[model samples]
Target chain A: MDATQLIHPLLALALAPLMAGIVNKTKSAFAGRNGPPVLQPYRDLWRLLHKGAVYSRTTSWILRAGPIVSLAAVVTALAMLPFGGTAAPLSFAGDLIVFAYLFGLVRFLMVAAALDTGSSFEGMGASREVTFSALAEPALLLALAALARMAGSPSLSGLLAGAVANPAVSIPVLLLAAAAVGIVLLAENARIPVDDPNTHLELTMIHEVMILDTSGPDLAFAGYAALLKQWAFAALLVGVLVPWRTGVLWADVALALAAMAAVAVGIGVVESTMARLRLVRVPQLLLAAVACAALAVVLVLR
Target chain B: MDFWVNCLVVLIAMTNLRLLGSSRVVSCVHTVAFQGVLLGVLAIVGASGGLAAHGIVLAAVNIVLKGLVFPWLLMRALRETHLRREVEPAIGFGASMLLGVLLIGICLWIGSRLPLPVGVQASPLLVPAALFTLMVGLFMIVARRKALTQVVGYLSIENGITAFGLGFALKEALLVELGILLDAFMAVFVMGIIIFHISREFDHIDAGELSALKD
Candidate 1:
C-alpha cells in the first residue's frame, strides 16, 4: 500500500477523541452552560496516558489484556473503512463480516474484563451491554447486507464506493440502510435513547459501568478505542448520507471530514432533544432498525 | 403515472405498518386520515380519462369525509370522552407487525393468482395493495381493545374497500359506489356518537367490555 492509503486510518486515530469533545460541547450548549473545550477529550486521554497503571488484586491476565486487545480490534476494523469514497488500506471480499465482528470482539473483551473484576455492579453492566449489543448486531449486519445487495458488492470499501457510484438505483435502498446504521451507531456508542454514556448514577449505566475499575494508561486505551470506534461508525454513516465523490483525493477527504463533524452535531442534537429509551424499550428501537433494514432488503429485491 | 402510483402504494403500506405498530390513539387517527387522503389521490389516478366526472366527485367526498370530517368528529369525541391512552393491545405490537408482514405476503400471492378484468389500465400492485390494507384494517379491529381504535380500524377497512373499488368498481354504476361511501360515512358518524355515550356510561371504551351486554 502507498503512503496515501495510510491517510484515512491515521486521520481517524488522531481525530477520534475530538468526537467526544464535540458531543460534550453540543450537550453543554443545549443545557446553556459553557462546556469543556472541543479538545477536552484529547487532553483527558493525554493525562491518562501519563499516569501509572493500576490493577485489581482479584483480576487475572485478562484484565491487563482487555484494553489493548479491544483497541487493536478497532484499529483493525478501521483499516477496511472507506471514508468518502476513498478506499481503505485493507480491502477484501467478506471484509464487512470481519469489520462487524471486530467490534464484537471489543465488546466480548470488555465484558470479559468486567466479569473478571468480580463486582456485581460490573456484572450488571456487562449483562446490559451484551443483551443490547446482541439485538443491535442484526441491525448492523442486515443494513450492510442491504447496501451490499444494492451495490452488488459484499465488501466494505466496495459497498461504500458502490453506494455512491450509482445514486438512481440506490437512493431508496441507501436511505433505508442509512437510518438503520444511524440507530446502530447510537446504540453501539452508548449514546442517548440507547444508553446514556454520561449518566451520573452507576445503577443505570451500560458501557461506562464496565470500565469503572480500570485506571491510568489502560483507561486511556479504553477511552481512545471507544472514540475511534465512534469515528469508524460515523464514517460509515457519512459515506452513506453524503455520496458526493469529486474524484480529487483532497476534496473527497475534506468533504468526509466535514460530514463527520456534521454527524457529531446531529448526534448532539438527538441527545439533547430526546430522553433515553426505557431499558425494555431499547430492544424495540433496535427492532425498528432491523425492520428498516429488512424493508430495505425487500425493496431492493423487489 | 406508474411511478406516482408506486409511490402511493409504498406510502399506503407504510401507513398500514405504522397503524399496526402505533400505541397512541391520536397518531393512529392521523395515520388513518393520511390513508384516507391517499385513497382520494388513488381514485383520481385510477380514472381512465383525464378526470372522470364521477371519479372527481368520489375523490372530493373521500377527501372530505375520510380525511377531514371523520377525524374531526373522532377528535371531538376523544376530547369529550377523555379516553386518550391505548398503551396495551390484545395483540402486542411486535406480533401484530409480524402478522402484518405475513398478511401482506398472502395478499401478494393471492393478488397475483386472481384474474384481473381485461383492459384495466391500473398497476398490477393494485390488487395486493388493496387486499393488504383490508387485512390490516381487520387485524387492527380484532386485535386492538379500545373502541376508538376499532372505529379507526373500521374506517381503515372502508379505506381498503374504497381502494379496491378504485380498481374494480369505478367502471360499474356510480350510484352503487356513492351508496357505499354514504353508508360508511353514516356508520362512522353513528359510531362516534355511540363511543361518546359508551365512555360517559362505562368510564372506559374497551370494546372487550361490550361482552357484558349479553346479560
Candidate 2:
C-alpha cells in the first residue's frame, strides 16, 4: 500500500475528534448556546493523557488492559475501511466479518473490565449493553451481509467499492443497509436516542456507567476510541450515501471527508430535533432498521 | 409514473408506522386523514388517461369524505370523550413497528405470489404497499385498546382498499365507489355516537374495558 491508501487512516485520525466537536456545535446551536471551541475534544484528550492513572483495589490486569485493547481493536478495524471507494491496505475476502467482531471484541473487553470492577452499577450497564447489542448485532450483520451479496463482494473494501462502481443495482441495498447501520451507529456509540453521552444520571446511563471507574490516560484512550468508532460508522454511512468516485485520489478522498462531515452534521441535527426514545422503545427503532434492511434484501431478491 | 407511485408507497408506509408508533389521539387522526389526501393524489396520478374527468370527480369526493368528513367525525367523538392520549398495552411501539415490518414482508411475499390483473399498469410496489397498510390497520384494531385508535385503524383499512382499487383503476362504475364511501361514513358516524355514550358511561373509552361487562 502506498500513500494513497494511507490517506483514509490519516484523514480519519485527524478528523475523528472534530466529528464530536461538530456534533457538539450543532447541538449547541439548537440549544441557543455558544458551545466550546471545535478543538475541545483534542484539548480534552491531551489533558487526559497527561493525568496520572488510578486503579481500584478490586481491579485486576483486566481493568488495566480494557481501554488499550478496545482502542487497539478499533484501530485494527479501521485498517480495513475504504475511504471514498479507495481500497483499504488490508482488504481481503470476509474481512468485513473480522472488521465487525473487532468492535465486538472492544465491547467484550469493556464489559469484562466493568464486571471485574465488581460494582453492581457497572454490571447493570454491561447487562443492558449486552441486551441491546444482542438485538443490534443481528440487524447490523444482516444489513452488511445483504449489502455484500448485493454488491457481490465478501469484503468491506470491494463491497463498498462495488457500490461506488455500480450505483444502479447497489443503491436500493445501500438505502436499506444505511438505515440499519445508522441505528447500529447510534446504539454502539451511545448517542442521544440510544444512550445519551451527555447524561450523568446513573439510572439512565448505558455506556457512561461502564466507564465510570476509568481515569487518566485510560479514560483518554476510551474517549478517543469512542470518537474513532463514530468516525468508522460515519465512514460506512458515507460509503453508502455518497457514491461519488472521482478517479483522482485526492478528489475522492476530499469528497468522502466532506461527506463524512455532512453525516456528522446530520447526526447532530437528528440529536437536536428528537428526544431519546424510552429504553423500552429503542428496540422498536432498531427493529425498524431491521425491517428496512430486510425490505432491501426482499427488493434485491424480488 | 412508477417512481411517483413508489414514492407514494413509501409515504403510505410511513403513515402506517406513524400510526403504529404514535399514541396520541389527534396525531393518529391526522395520520389517517393524511392517508386520505394521499389516496386522492394516488387516484389522479394512477389514472390511465391524462386527467380524466371521471378520475377528478372521484378524487375530489374521496378526499372530501375520507379526509374531511371521517376525521372530523372522529375528532368530534374525541372531543366529547375528552380522551387526549392513551397508554398502550399488549405491545410496545417498538414491537408494534417490528410487527408492522414483518407484516410488510408478509404482504410483499403475498403480493408477489398473487398474479396481477391482466394488463394493469400498477407499479410493482403498489399491491404490497396496499396489502401492508391493510395488515397494519387490522393489526392496529386488534392490538389497540382505545376505541378512537381502532376507528383510525378501520379507516386505514378503507384507505388500503382504496389504494388497492387505484392499483387496478377498474373504475367501470363510479357509483359503487361512492356507495362504499357512504357506507363507511355511516359506520364512523354511528361509531362516534357509540363512543360518546361509552365515554359517558365509564369515563373512559378503552374498548378492552368493555370485556369486563356482565350480562
Candidate 1 per-residue C-alpha lDDT over A1-302 given as tens digits, one digit per residue, 9 for 90 to 100: 67777889999998998888898899999999999999999999999999998898999988888999999999999999988656799999999999999999999999999999999999999999999999889989988988888788879988888445544346656777888899999999999999898896888999999998899999999999999999999999998887778889898999999999999999999999999988987887777677667766766665
Checking candidate 1 for backbone clashes, the offending pairs are none
Q: Write the per-residue lDDT of candidate 1 for residues B1-215, one digit (tens) a residue.
A: 65566557766876887788887899999999999999899877767668878888888988998899999988988888899566458998877876776676678778879888787666666777788889888998899988899998998888888888788745464677788889988998899999988897799888888888864
Candidate 1 accuracy as lDDT: 0.85
Instruction: Give the fraction of reference interface contacts each candidate recovers.
Output: 0.00, 0.30
- TM-score, each model? 0.87, 0.91
Pick the lDDT winner: 1
- What value does the lDDT take at residue A292 in candidate 1? 68
TM-score, chain B, predicted structure 2: 0.95
Candidate 2 local lDDT, B1-215, one digit each (tens) = 65566666767876887788775788889999999899889888778768778788879988999889998899888887888576454577777877877787888889989998698888777899899888888988998888888888899898898888888776574676777778888999999999998899899988888999999
